[model samples]
Target chain A: MLYREAGQFKTTYAADMAVFPIRQDRIALALLVAVAFIAVPFMAEAQVWPFRTDYMVRAILIPFLILSLAAVGVNILIGYCGQISLGSGAFMAIGAYSAYKFATGVHIPLAWLGTAISIPPLPGLISIPLGGLMAALVGILFGIPSLRIKGLYLAVATLAAQFFFDWVFIRVKWFVNYNSSGSVSAPDMYLGPIHINTPVERYLLCLSAVVIFATLAKNLVRGNIGRQWMAIRDMDIAAELMGIRPLYAKLSAFAVSSFIVGVAGALFAFMYLGAWEPLAFDINRSFQLLFMVIIGGLGSILGCFLGAAFILILPIMLDQIPHAVGIPVSVETVSHLVFIVTGGLICYLLIVEPRGFARLWGIAKEKLRLWPFPY
Target chain B: MVEFGQFLEILIGGLLSGVLYSLVALGFVLIFKASGVFNFAQGAMVLLAGLALVRSLDFLVARGIPMPVAILMGLMFAGLVMALTAWLIERFVLGPLVNQDGLTLFMSTIGATFILEGAAQMIFGSDVYPLPLFPTDAWFLFESAFPGGILVNKLDVWGGLIAAILVAGLALFFQRTKTGRALRAVADDHAAAQSVGIPISWIWFVVWLVAGLVALVAATVWGTKLGVQFSITFLALKALPVLIIGGFTSVPGAIVGGLIVGAGEKLAEAYLGPQIGGGIEYWFAYVLALAVLLVRPQGLFGERIIERI
Candidate 1:
């Protein structure tokens, strides 16, 4: 069988500890990367069957990749660290608005105090990570509560951050650069001399960013810090007794998770929406990301992508299904049905398979290893 | 003097609306106490119940039924609908998900919430339905002492009165009834209660039923106040702070928490809105709850949590 590891034995410790320990997994990953990087773009350029319209790439793939990246970040905190955060939208907003501030620059004049301060604009690429760093700083600040509150209470507490940041971005005109309409547009994105304007260009940009972040996240989770997070998640007291400081583990999880999520937010605003208000990163965004982590496998890197794809594709499929079948249903009815089916599916997943699609993939892999062997 | 009266008026108004919050929070406390599931769908339940009641009332009135009889029939129909919903949720959702971690259970309830919200909209129509069960007029008090008296809404007073009656009735039920004793026993320890011949699933169904009926009462009041619509689901968001401040496990804690949240947010909005950009109430209750959580993680009335490793 293709998945059988009978002839593949790791003689070195580094080889054994590699993220993709099995040969089949590494090959599969390479094939996947090839498809994402080369084939997809080639198809989009050639205007192939599914890629005839840029809508698929622009609308679906771009948001999917961005949300998947955000889910990876959220997975680090909730799935990896065992801290439930319903305030991820707040962190995303922080990343986005801060990135916007850094990219466009800001001028704050204290006329009453007879002083003024101004920030010079940074490049778009530079500001995205800077936005992430700002989110990390705020993530650390908010994560202080996790030391005391635990479980559902902590989840509810995180909403304070969501609502607070939402208010901050909406009410404080300084953040929005005093736009009377209270909406901000993405700054011009230039990678050296190349402009990321076209849908294909934007898709590739997001894809590459996702690749780097996903790889980094995978490596992080397999490292010592990830173990610390898992330990804290599994049993904080026991982990503490074992010399893993809950403070360090929890805060670092927040920092790393928020940083990734923040970067994703910047990408989402700049690449996807192009123009957005505070409503772009509201509580529902947090829930949507959380749902991705839930439906995807909790602790698996691959699960994030799987969950994001499934959650994103579901509504589209539901929308198309009725029309495809020639059923005359109102848009409202279809939307209501979408909610019902989504809710029903979530319940079903929780009840039947709490581990989600990742577990299903795992089961398939296990089966593959024994294919053609009867025993 | 006029400012003082205005302040009292705001305070009184806040306290009364806080009573309505308590009514919603009460449903959450009931389910959490009995089944360890934080029912996020309570707001949706309120919406569904209100919709059912209002729609039924409209139907009966259109058929030439008397006003009083129509009201009675609508209440009964809504109660039946709630009871059916309780049974279905317990059978399909909560029953299978028993003994899951609190977070998983909580998330599942949210899933349930989406289903209920969608189903309610589909069945009852998504448009807002007005329930004029109570007078919406305001009463002026102490006009002799002050040039302009404090204004109090009649609806809020009715809400407070109903909440008091509901609490008293619940207390009596818990104190005097066999089923109530069984419920308390189950809340104490699930395994032990099961060992002593209590049907855990049946108890869960009953608890959900009780919570459903409570949602009905809340919907009747809230629907009358705000008009039943999709926005009622958001009341779940507002009630969360109340649950946190009051402690998740205590009924009286819910009432007190609701009062604090209502008064605190209203006071902050009125006094602080001008200085700030307004809409402070949106996060004010949550911030207060967070502060409480920091000082007393178990909340004001929640039982002390003892973790074992």
Candidate 2:
């Protein structure tokens, strides 16, 4: 009775076409935002979850947010666009390295109509999107083959991007600013008087960025472009016959996906790992993001968040479970167990619920309205 | 400028490494041809098999077993582990998700890859194990025969020879054997083969087992050269360009693709590395393969992909 949408009639087309048409959804979203903005920051860091910064905010939420952003990007390409990419990590790395460069080395002199002007270097806040644009350009360049190759063959072709970017970052000193050690520290993120240095600040910054991107992603999918993407994904020839240009849809999907992914990469680097080497964004990172999108719920925006939470929090929970039971588990044993459990769970999810957690949640909601009735 | 002899040495050396890459790619082709599941776990299988082999060898030698006997026993243990892996995959991963889409199956294999990698590391401990090099004294002598002092590792020559024999053996098996013909049929049409009295799951099990065994042989050869370690699993990415250039389903294509990739990579590194600050070998094969793919969407040796409305 509490969850019912009864008597909530839509009076206009604008109200009916709303993202959250139900009044209850708007309230829930407001409460969620309120809790995230207010309650969490006030709570001190502790070993226990929910109130614990170490467990909840730092270890779990930060990575979850960053990965969710990346998952959204992957979801757009693989889920919405019908393009299977194995090089999400490559795009991420490009965004991160480019952002790092922009934050550090973008102070240049512009000669405009015989007048010389020195351009001030932008801060990390501005550099992140610039990094994303670079990745978008690169993503579109690599996406040229999608016109010809589809499915698994297209997936393999994308690996060329991953390996190529990886080599460039690792071997070329210019990308890493000639850091001989190959490990680069993320530039400080500053905006006037505000300094995003603390974990809370970092969490807020990442959360806001992810929320903005997630909103943009949802809006994009709900629009005509999203229809075009689904058209191509379902059947490119059919979509093309329907007057939806395959090249435009496919390339736009790549651009949008890579842009979000690139931003996520910058956040992943600067926010999560303070100092990172090229090895962090290897092929495994791409696989991890793909797994997130797959298990979260393909093509759903909420699925990205859900998938990221499930994947990132799983190992941490597994690590702590033995200790909670007063049995000391070796780190290596825990690591191995995490992998086996994770792999086993993925197979189970694919077999039993290939639609993933989002669909399951939808089913649950449907069942909830039926009350005490037995299906 | 590099001497003509030096160029020949690089070319020969590259061809040898390419042959090794073909062994890995051949394993992939076998499984892909039979099941249409591009088994991503092939590299993890190699790592697991190598770990089993080397660990078993260590166990035998520690107990004062003779060298030849220990080696044979280690090989047997590795084979046994591979067989067990095939059974596990058949039972859990493939059987339950039989009619899923291609991407779902591929993703499942990725899960399988992680589980195997973790389990292997847990069992064997993630330390690199070096094997005694197989004797190729004649190859060493030939290296000395070349001018400009370009040295070739004798073991690499033997690796190439073994790889050639492996390809020939596989070709014969596919040509002459009933199971091989069944695998080919399954590759051609799964439902038709199942209706025609070919057991699809059984064929899948055999393909995975055969692929696992191929992985084992490759691990032995590669472990001897590079010392079986974590990086070997990533070498699967290296073999990818070979698979792309040649074709995913063809054995001879893998071999030819490997030769082109291997030779091309080495030549680029030698001739163009100085201009690019070196290490061009890493991405050169992929770029070359991508260029080729642009010209022919169907790989050089792959069957033409036909799309119908």
iRMS, model 1 (angstroms): 1.6
Segments of candidate 2 deviating more than 4 angstroms: A44-56, A107-119, B136-138, B141-145, B148-150
Tell me the lDDT of candidate 2.
0.86
CA-only RMSD, every prediction? 1.5, 2.8
lDDT tens digits by residue: candidate 2, A192-266: 779888787888899899889999999999999999999998888889999998889999999999999999999
TM-score of chain A, all candidates:
0.97, 0.93
lDDT of 1 at B224: 93
lDDT by candidate, in order shown = 0.91, 0.86
Tell me the tens digit of each residue's lDDT in model 2 across B1-309.
Answer: 347778888898898888889889999998988888888888899999999999889899999999999999999999999999998998899988776777888889988988998899898988899866376443433455564466677777787888888888998888899999999998887778889999888988898999999999999988887787878897678888889899888889999999999888999999999998788887898898888777876678988878632
TM-score of 2: 0.94
lDDT of 1 by residue, A1-375 (tens): 767888888999999988889998889989999999999999999999799999999999999999999999999999999999999999999999999999998677889989988889999999999999999999998899999888888898889899999999999998998899999999989999998899999999999999999999999999999999999999999999999989899999999999999999999999999999999999889988888898887888889999999989988887888789998778788778867877787788899988789999999888989998948
Clashes of each: 0, 0
* DockQ category of candidate 1: medium
